[model samples]
Target: MTKDTMSIDTSAELLENDILPMIREVHTDPDVPCASQGDMPKALAEPVAKKSPAQWAYERIIMYIQNFEKQLDNDHEVGMGLAGGNTGVIRIEGLGYYDPDIVTYYGTSEAGAKTQLIQHVSQLNVTLIASPKHIDQPEPKRIGFRLAAGLERSEDVTT
Candidate 1:
């Protein structure tokens, strides 16, 4: 076989055997049901051939967030604690990744004001928390599944 073809085969083998396993091992939580490699959305899993670091981090984080939400009672929803200051937690309503570097979060602050945090992948530090759902609001919708679905749709359009 040609050198290029052999290298591509080696890369795919490494990703399947080494990288995916390490990700599963590191992110495994005893309390939450983590998504197995097989459970990864086709858009996210199949397109790993070319992705930015921020995109990779975003996809993995989405899986973890989805798993964490599964363990929450209806009375609680997922919130994210930002790093580096008195920046309070935000209810994670939406998440996005911008090409090679940025990860953006959209949600409401503790006081219920709309908020968004745009962060570099290098500085991304996330702490997912289960916060009490607002008294008047119905159970918060799980954003992870929605996000994954969006990825699928976008992939469909691109391909």
Candidate 2:
């Protein structure tokens, strides 16, 4: 669930490590998957993610940031991927404080409800939802990964 079969190098040359912390819009709710009753736990199956789809997407980005905070090293890399234009890359110099967000596209027209759904890197409250990943072999892609400091957490974790 870490590196891909073919490594894609993303050198950290975007910004200086002397970047300051930005108080981005705080996020709380998590992007919980509506798993089938059999596939999910008692708590997950419940109605937890009451936030609007936009909020859910934002929390997902925050979760990704918190999880990746642990696995990546000081010399780590970053890149850009598209989730229907719902994502933007935010690299903070030397610190791996990546944070992806979800921009809302109110109307679903020919433009195709465009919104940002990024996989950002940052800290988060453990009270949020736990990792929403499948334990199956070859873990799913880290669409919403988090990188909290220390090993008592998941690499692509949320809470």
**Best prediction by TM-score:** 1
Q: Per-residue alpha-carbon lDDT of model 1 for 81-107, expressed as tens digits?
A: 988887799999988888888998999
Tens digit per residue, CA lDDT, model 2, 16-73: 2222122233336444322111122222222223333433334343434444433443
Question: Candidate 2 — which residues are off by over 4 angstroms?
Answer: 1-49, 77-79, 83-159
Off by over 4 Å in 1: 1-21, 26-31, 47-49, 153-159
Error of 2 at 85 (Å): 9.2
Global lDDT of model 2? 0.30
Error of 2 at 87 (Å): 11
lDDT on C-alpha atoms for all candidate structures: 0.76, 0.30
Can you give the TM-score per candidate against the true fold? 0.78, 0.26
TM-score of candidate 2 against the unseen true structure: 0.26
Clashing residue pair totals per candidate (backbone < 3 A): 0, 26
